[model samples]
Target: MGKILRAIKKIIPEPIFDFFSPVYHWILSLLAAVIYWFPSRRGRMKVIGVTGTSGKTTTVEFLYRIFTDAGFKTASLSGLWFRISDKSEPNLLKMTMPGRFRVHRFLYEAKKAGAEYVFIEVTSEGIKQYRHKFIKFYAAILTNLSEEHLEAHGGFENYRRAKGETRI
Candidate 1:
């Protein structure tokens, strides 16, 4: 599946792909929300987003413990792994951020499990690919800026802007 997808991507003109990327993601995000009923719609769960060049997974893990210890049910999505309340697992997707549907699905599970907070590790690449779409974040913590994902974002400044978008 991955191989085929990559081949298809390679066939598309870069400019055309770039132009449609946002629209593709936006439609999927919205479609996923509609099918799943947008778990964040009720406003009961607060998503705490963590984005940066490094240490995002660690930060999310730390915040998860804090929230859990403080008696709030916590869920988290990190590059290293993900957790739903007390349950946890390794991140098998390889992608630091999961795709549009998985994101909403995770939130649905969290909401169903009565999670009060979900801390996510946001990435510049993830944002560019629209993996950060649709979630209503209560707060965003930016650890720092670096020259990471420069090629993906086209330059350092663009990289920073992509990371910064998580705050919005």
Candidate 2:
């Protein structure tokens, strides 16, 4: 019986090894779209995007604090938290990047909550996958560049291109 099960597993393609992968991602993308679209249709929002090898979280937090202090309703998605228009809490994402659609969704939710401003921490990998495509930024802060995630990006030049592409 064990041998039969093993044989069945071996016969299955590696890509088909996880049956839930496609369904899971589809659900997530749909959720993200719903969250972003509803609030955006209501009014205009000022979006601030921060991308770098380090200090993304700190920079986002600083901007959040400043915006809130100025009395604007603000929402921020950083390494530490997923904030929705003055209602911030710890990020519960099981995966670091979550999904390609998550950032857009979070922005959508913030907009729904009447957030005047939104801040996001854009990662190099996310940029590579074209996750930052949909959202328009009012301002972008590029803190600094460094070497990281060389394996996925192939080399330093590819990594730099991944980061630099975000600016265009």
lDDT of each: 0.84, 0.73
C-alpha RMSD by candidate, in order: 1.7, 6.1
TM-score of each: 0.91, 0.73
Return the number of clashes found in candidate 1.
0
Q: Per-residue alpha-carbon lDDT of model 2 for 1-168, expressed as tens digits?
A: 449756866888767845744464456555665656644335688777788788888999999999889999999888789887557778787533445566776766687688998888878877765566556677788888888888988998988887776652
Error of 1 at 117 (Å): 0.6
lDDT of 1: 0.84
Leading candidate by TM-score: 1
How does candidate 2 score on lDDT?
0.73
